[model samples]
Target chain A: MSIDPGMLLAIAMMSAVTYFTRLAGFLLASRLSLRGRARAAIDAIPPAVLFALIAPVVLTHGWPETLAAAAAGIAALRLPLLGVIAIGIAAVVILRALF
Target chain B: MTVQSEYQSSTADEIRQGLADIAPVLVAMVPIGLLFGAICTTKGWAASDVWLMSTLVFSGGAEFAAIGLWKWPIPYLALFVSTALVSARHILMGVSLAPKMHAFKGWRLWAAAWFMTDEAWALGERRARRQTITVAYWFFMAVPVHLVWVASTVTGSMVGPMLGDPAAIGLDFAFTALFIGLIAGFWKGATTAWVLVASGGASALVALTIGEPWNVLAGAAAGIVAAWFTATEPDEPESSSPEGHLL
Candidate 1:
């Protein structure tokens, strides 16, 4: 398929906005030390951010996908990283095909 | 502990250490990159487009959002707005890492910032809390993951057409499974577990109500606020052996 210049432009802008946050963090963090309530919030940010990233995908896709993903995730928790990935992928495929 | 353990010798050495620390995460990351690549390819994106997206945006979630928008042929302004909303977590990531990375200056900080991802931030934050400031360690962690991401995208783009739908083959499960693995690995105690549940539950509720990218923002805001309110005293002893250091 032909690459659209518009799509490329959009991608570049998205990239810039995305990179801005990281750059901002690095630059800003160097200037000040976070502590107290701020530190507490920062500490909590990862799980919150991660959940934000994951929850929507699972919800939009439906419960079956969520359950399957959860099961695969649990399986991944028990196995080696590669094995977990393989099993997770397998579970999704099987569940999709069966359901 | 040996002197080697006491101080990272050089920037290159520190980067190597960081990358070594992040190796286990690649298992989770590779599949995600592959999926993203597959999605882009399936959308009929060329190999160059795939690489450019991966390299430039360097954000799995944002890239996914961009591709989703691409399907609609959304205008560039709308795409940018959606991406910004989706990637709002980066603001939090920036805030969290700011204190720890205060020593870095100019271009070096910029480069490191570019490498920050959810996985990288989790690992980096944990290490920074432990006070591991060797530039090499951070570099090592970020560079390899970045490479794997780009490489997997290339692989996915090339093989994406030939492969059937990821949902058809169950590869989609890898994304959630990887996250679960990450969550489980970091489950230090009840507080952490509760925080996760609250975040997930809140995010889902908001998502069900608000829809699309708004759910992401609402969920994240809810989780952060809940965590802030339920903040625990840092009296508990730090774990000496953090997970993901086996290699």
Candidate 2:
């Protein structure tokens, strides 16, 4: 249950780096104006970063996961957020059971 | 500024609203947090270490990456670099949100930065673009997720043996589902199609070939590039231009 000083220090380092990243944007934005292409890039970050996370999970897992994600994506278009997630999870479970 | 004080009265409502707004994602987070704690425990990590990491690091991707890379001697420098890279996305999240969050100052601003996470950032971005939001809203949205996450991780670490396999019941899909829904929430018209395709395609390609965090960076890079071109359409007026659109 006890952690060594090294591990604690290492964890501290991780937290520091993460906090730095979080703060960097705000600091940078204060100093510099984000316009034109720079603004576009920053704007693109949300969906892009999110998709980047999602894409690999879908592709690597193959059809079952793909179908499930697709169901989620499609449901997300119309259903409530919780409903969409429910559909996606249900799809995975149902598909897993069926095949 | 005087404006900050005007917001002071509404803080309670904003926090409550923020908590309600993020409620959907919280459902999915429970299993993931528990799964994370269970994984750490299985890896021989102390329960305290699991809680400490979740509370301090507060990043699912980075913490998972760290545990995946865990071994004797800890590989301190390598672990730091990898986790940092995996979490590098936070920089973009902060940048994307900074404009909307400009009104927040002092401790409020610092706390917002500390509480920032991909889910909260996504939700905040949607709200900020649509309407003005308060610092309280931001904190409420972000902090509760952290609290629930930490609690679930602790629960998983302590009683991991009883929970059985998270994936067996398809609870693992909850993470992906939540992201899918959140991405949908960020949808911004037709142009988003190509941007998402490019992001997803590049990410999948890099993931299949190189693996780990690089795919995340590559996807973000590709998305930004693709969006730049798409936003620069000849017909669109400069004033109406899609500068900050997710596409």
- True-contact fraction per candidate equals 0.63, 0.68
Q: For residues B145-185, write the lDDT of model 1, one tens digit per residue.
A: 78899999878888876766656556566667666655555
TM-scores of chain A in all candidate models: 0.67, 0.85
TM-score of chain A of 2: 0.85
Taken over the whole model, the C-alpha lDDT of each candidate is: 0.69, 0.81
TM-score of 1: 0.80
> What lDDT tens digits, residue by residue, belong to model 2 across residues B1-247?
1122223446677778788889998888999988888888878888899888889988889888888887778789888898789888888787778767766877777888888888888898877655565777888788988899899998888888788998898999998888898888767665577779899999999999998799999998899888888876533433432223311
Task: Give the distance in Å from residue B172's predicted Cα in candidate 1 to where it truly belongs.
Answer: 1.0
Best by DockQ: 2
lDDT by residue (tens digit), candidate 1, A1-99: 466787677777888898887776656555554444455555677766776667765656766677666775677557755566666666667666766
